[model samples]
Target: MAKPKLPIPVTLLTGYLGSGKTTLINHVLSNQEGYKCAVIVNDIGEVNIDAELIQKTGVVTQKDDNLVPLSNGCICCTLKVDLINQIAELVKSGKFDYILIEASGICEPLPIAQSIAVLEGDEEEGTPAICRLDNIVTVVDALRMATEFGCGDNLLKDDVDEEDIESLVIQQIEFCSTIILNKVDMVNEEQLGRVKAMIKTLQPKAKIIEANYGKVSVGDILNTNLYNFEETAGSAGWAQAYDKDEDERNEHHDHDEDEHEHHHHHDEDKHEHHHHHHHDGEDHSNCDHEHGHCCHHHHHGDDDEEYGIGTFVYHSRRPFNQEKLQEFVNNWPKGVVRAKGILWFSDKDKRDYLYVFEQAGVQITATENGKWLAAFPKSEQKKYFKEYPDIEEHWDEKYGDREIKLVFIGQHMDKPNIIERLDNCLDD
Candidate 1:
């Protein structure tokens, strides 16, 4: 019998933290019609929570009958060795038709793609065949994006740079043939419009798909190659958005920056600033609406250069005052759009802790602890109380204490002032 094929196509699923890469991979693997698929999971940080979640789905195949988990450093960086070994083993197994590799959160997808592309000659004698680049599909958290990047929520950690997150998202888009905008259900009409507009600005060539819980056909995820680095290099959101002449006609420009600034002068006001004025004369007709979310490209010229300031903040330490923080949220800056992080509240009611992803002035939804307090039944609550000696009597009936960990995305936002204000909001 002839050799099956020269090289199999490998699909890459990558995104930043909590952007739903694992969710998408699980969706594809579970819904696969007949394809013999092999999945490789790469996780970051000390926890392999995503890897465990995927394994629980029963979609992950074993390596030499042993489950392969690379959960130390980033897959694109320190874990490349494990990544290669596992993929090679999967290929040699000769049981899979397609291979799906999910990169760790904070990983750069280009290196992962380059690794697969360059490994064509690494297959040993018994290995099925080499692997080739099929497609790089990057998932973006639409709701998180709307609150973090589109709106400019300056609630990120002090040291974290918001620009890095924007640049990272753009880089992921640069290499992807397909871009999955996940969490479409989290935004309102206006917030959705900003999210799509920003995505179109960043990745114009990619075939954008609206996804909820990473639900997209596996076929679309595989066997597609829309990557053209030459074309994508200069034309990505960073450049071409403001240069469209046809769009220039319907666009409106206001010279009054002072007027926009006047609306955001309050120091502790719980609201956001808004400077991108949509004039009535401007025809937003060409915009495409996917599930009521309007998306269109922008012509980036002097206007964008004047307005686009990518900022990110990474803060590991600090506790936030709930009341002051809520007031800050109530008066968030308009230029500052999105922010997602674990929040440590200091209030007697909700001081336990919570995760926050703010978009369009709404803090999406906060989840309760599932591990400790939430797991105990009413009858077992007293018994479980002994397990956690640190639990306060009143705190048990209230909430669980988590932490304030968040990723902030902002555009043209004042980093210094934002950080100062956030620091002030926290306990001394």
Candidate 2:
């Protein structure tokens, strides 16, 4: 028999909106110091992540083929099976030294951590885990901490349900082995201290680090091998409710203390796709409804949204006047917490091109991505459009395959009004 390999480290990279998860990933991938790693992005978008985007950032490793996107739903809840399967695939591939699972801004980390533990135990779950939960690294936005924590009392008072982002953030802080507070440049010394204090209250166990532009030693976040599933099981307030689900799972069976200790994975062990029925008859895969910052996958078994932050996508086939777009970007709505997408700007000579935009809170960043694929010859469109099928459908004869497509996630959004305002900026 071939010599068996050691367990691969699977790190969970999580954070809230604009907390610098991508920045950290890009930083680590670009400066891997000879250590190869693969990334599994849980994209909060319409389709799987575009491979070209990662290439444009120049962060892909030799194991670029390992770029997997679980865009259907949140892996911690609705898409845990996909998470498990992907873990198995990466482990089997054995091309990467480490694997990073970057969760959405609204995900709670404990259950996700707990789910990974299931793979290691001797169980009927598919493909025995060839990897282990190495670390749970949460990238938090230091600038938003004081504000998020200030609404502490009644905001996320959902009684053990991880419905609100506030509860989710607290859970992330509590469960993580490493907490990275990014964007420290935006806050002063006194404010940073207060942010640190707030994090310490919920997560005394995590090793906290402050970073700007997501710059940090890769050694700090990867290969630490610090996760202990037993400690994870008993640590959080949100996990208490899952305990009851565990009790119900074994309520009919007889078992000893040893069995009891290892029986959590047995809850619906054979049923792979776990889901709770919803009144609207939608699976968690389809219930990505807009709330504000509190969006949770509703059809996930035991997961429901009592509070949700609104998320809206602005699409325009008409090209935006560069001056108007710049003005709007300069005065972006304060309520808009995060926004990103490709935009087509008018001005035939200098400005008639496509641009990729990223907005975190009020900060805006844009980069030219050459012309839209539709602008190229029909012979060349196949290769580019084939790489991203979801975006290809938006092509037009006059405008080619270009327009404005951005997703805004935040509170109290006026979708129709926002669309109208954006429409007013269009030259066509």
Per-candidate local distance difference test? 0.56, 0.60
Largest TM-score belongs to which candidate?
A: 1
Q: State TM-scores per candidate.
A: 0.53, 0.51
Q: Candidate 2, residues 1-428: lDDT per residue as tens digits?
A: 33235477888988876688877888887887866677887865556443335545766632567677778578778888888888777777767778888887667787787677766756564555577888889988887875654432323434324455654665577677888999888888766776675454334446888899889998887888676665543433223222322233235222311111111101121312222211232312111112101111112111111222334445555677888978887766644545555576777863446676766433367777566555567767766567655334434446565556565544445555666667667786
| TM-score, model 1 to reference | 0.53
TM-score of predicted structure 2: 0.51
- What is residue 420's positional error in candidate 1, in angstroms? 28
lDDT tens per residue, model 1, 1-428: 33336576788888877888988988987888876677777765577777688778776645333246678677787887778888877777666667788887667776776566555654465444477767778898888777765444433433333325654665676456788989888888666666666565455567889889999877789776554334433344323322232134223322211101011111221111112222122222232112111112222333333446332432322356767876777777555544543455556655433444333223333443222343345555555447643333323123332323333443566655665566667762
Best by lDDT: 2
